[model samples]
Target: MSHTLLNESNADQYRTRVTLLGTAGGPPWWDGSDRTGISTVISVNDDHYIVDLGEGWGPQFRKSNLGPVGFQKGLDNVRAVFVTHHHSDHIVDLPNLLLLAWHNGSDGLKSPIQIYGPGNRGELPPIFAPENREQLPEVFNPDSPTPGLTESAAKLMEAYALDINDRMRDNAKQDLRDVFEFHDIELPGTTGDRPNEDPTPEMEPFEVYRDENVRVTAILVDHRPIFPAFAFRFETADGSVVVSGDTGVCENIVKISADADMLLHECIDMDWVDTLMGPNSPKPDANLMQHMLAAHTSIEQVGPQAQAARVKSLVLTHLVPGNTPAEKWQQAAAGYDGDFYVGEDLMQFGIGAPRG
Candidate 1:
C-alpha cells in the first residue's frame, strides 16, 4: 500500500491505530522490497507510543506519514517508547530515535520521552576468580557491567556527549539531557541476579506507565536465557492492544492478551529457518539452536495461542522468514478463526474496528 493512503480518518475517530513500522525478524537482509527490523507505532487519540525501535525504524516511521514534515516535528509526536528487551535487533535505532526526536522538538513534548524496559543482568564474576575454576573466564565474561535500562541509557547519552554538546551550543540550543526519561522494569528479588538463570518470580501483570490517554501493563514472557523479556498491553478508552515483544509459547502473553481488541504477536517458521540453514550446511551449534527454539514462538504456536486469548483480531509480525510467501502465512493461521493478517511494513490497523 502507498504511504499516502494512510489518512487520518481513524485518528479522527478518537480510536487507536497501530502501524507496522517494520516486520522483518532478525535483521534487514531481504532484497526485493523486503521487511526492515521489527517496530510498531501505537497511536491512541493523538498521542503516539512506539514499541521496539528496531533498525531502519526511522525511515519506516517517516514512510507511515504519521508525523509532520520536518524531522523534529515529525518525531515530536512520539509520546513514549517501550522496549521489550535489549537485543540489538530490537533496539538498534534507539540512539537515532532519541537524537532525532530531541533535535526536533514539538510544543506537545512538555517532558522527556519516557522509555521503559527490563533492568540489566547481574555482573559475571571476574575471570580467574574461584567461580571461574570450571569455566574459561575470558569466554564466559559478561557482555557489559551495566546493571539495567537506566544505566544503559546513561551510557548511550555519555557516548554522544560531545555531539550533543556541539549541537546544543551551535544549532538546536537545547539540552538533549532533558529529552528522555528512562525507567527500568524491575521485579522483586530479581536485581543483582543473572536474568536467564534467575527469572523474575511469577507475578500478576502490573502497570508500567500511564498518562491521560493510555495505560500500559506488562507481563513477563519466557524468552529464556534473555531474562525478563516482556509483552505489553496498552489500554485506552476505545480499545486494548497487546504487543508480544519476542517470546516462546508463554502463557503470560496469552493471559495478558485475553479479550484484547488486537494482538500483535511475533512468529517464526522453524522449518523455513532450517531450510535456510540447509541439511548439507553445518548444523547450528546445539547451544544456538536451544536458544532459538526457547526464545522464539513458532508459527504453529501462534494460532492456538491467539485462539486461547480470544483476541478480536490477530496480526503476526517480527516474522522469522520475513520473505515467506503470503500463502504460507495463511497455512500458519489455519486454526485462528478471528481476523488475521500477515503484517507488512507500513500496514496500519485501527483498533476497536477491523483492519484498515
Candidate 2:
C-alpha cells in the first residue's frame, strides 16, 4: 500500500496527532543522512508530551512548529516528558531541554513539566565476555555506578549551577525547580528484581502516568545489559499509540502495543551490522555483532512484530545508521499489510477520523 503523508494542515480531522521530532538513532554522525536524533511528541489538542531528548532535539522541535509563535514560546505547552532509556543517543541533549527551557518560554508553563525515566540499577551490569580481556576497566563512578533519572537530573543541575544561578539572579528567570519535576518510574514489584539475569521478564504493561488528556503505560523490553529499557503506550480518547523503545523482538512489546492505532517502532539494518562487524571486516568480533543484533529489531523483524500486535498502522522511526536508502527501508512492509510509513523529521500523524 502507498504511504500517506500526515501533517499539520490536515491534523484538524483527528483528535490526537503525533509528530516525529528527530528520527535518527545511535551516536555516530551517519553519512548521507541529515536526520537529527531520536525524539517524538504526542499532541492532544493544545498540549504536547515529549518522548526522548536526543541530540539536536531543540532545533528540530522548533522546525516542527508544534508550539505557539513568538519569543521564548517553543516549549510552553510541553506537559510532560518520557525517557525510554539512558542511552546517550536517546538522552544526550537532555541538558539542552533542562537548561535552555528558561530562554525558551518555560516560564509560561502551566505547571511543572513532569519528567519520567528509568530508576537506578542497584548493582552494575556484568562485564560482557570478560575472559578475553587482559584486565577489566575501572568503574567510572564507584559510589553511584548507575544513577537513574531523578538522581541524574539532580547532578545535571549541580553541574550547571553557575549558569543556572547566572540566569536566575541576573536575568531574572523563573526558578527551574518550579518549572520542572523529575520522577524515576517504579517497576512492578514482582518483576525487574534480576536485572542482569533477566532484564525483560514477560509481564503485562503497567500504568506509569495519567492526565486529563492521555494515559501512559510501560513495559520492560529486551534491551539487555541496559536494564530497565521500556516501551511506552499512550492511550488517548481517540486512539492509542505505542513507542517501541530500543529493544529486540520481545513478547512484552506486542502485549503493550496490542490493538494500538499506530506502533512507532525502531528498525535496524542487519546488513549494515554485518558489513561493519561481520567476519569479513578487518577485525571481526562475533560477540559485538551478536550484541548489536540482540538489542535492536531489524527491518525484516519489525513488520512481523507489528503484525503480531494487530496495529492499524506501523510507522518506522529511529532508523538505524540513519542514512540507509528509503527504498531499502520500504522492504520492512513485507509480512504486514497495515499502513507503513518511513517516518521523516517533522512529519505528523493524526489519529481517528478527519474533520468534515
Best by lDDT: 2
- Across residues 1-356, which tens digit of lDDT does each residue of candidate 2 receive? 11235766776566688889999999999989999999999988768899999899899888777777787457888999999999999999999989988778744566899999999987798998899799999999898999999999999999999999998899988888998999999998768999999999989899999999999999999998897899999998778999999999999999999988999999999989988879998768899988988899999999999999999899999999899999999999999988899988888888876544
TM-score of each: 0.86, 0.97
Among residues 3 or more apart in sequence or in different chains, the pairs in candidate 1 whose N, CA or C atoms overlap within 3 Å are 72-104, 120-148
Q: Candidate 2, which segments miss by more than 4 Å at Cα?
A: 1-4
lDDT string for model 1 (1-356, tens) is 10111345644453578899999878658666478999999987657899998889998887777776554447666789999987778988888976776555554356678899888656432332355258554533256653567887788889988888887888755577677889998665434255545454456778889999899999888776565688999998668889998888777888899998888999887776675454544654444555577778887888998999998888899987777777777766767898888888888876664334
Model 1 lDDT-worst window of ten: 1-10
Least lDDT summed over 10 consecutive residues: which range in candidate 2? 1-10
CA shift at 270, candidate 2, in angstroms?
A: 0.9
Mark the regions of model 1 whose C-alpha exceeds 4 Å error after superposition: 1-14, 69-73, 106-108, 123-146, 188-194, 198-201, 276-281, 284-290, 353-356
Q: In the order shown, what is each candidate's alpha-carbon RMSD?
A: 4.7, 1.9
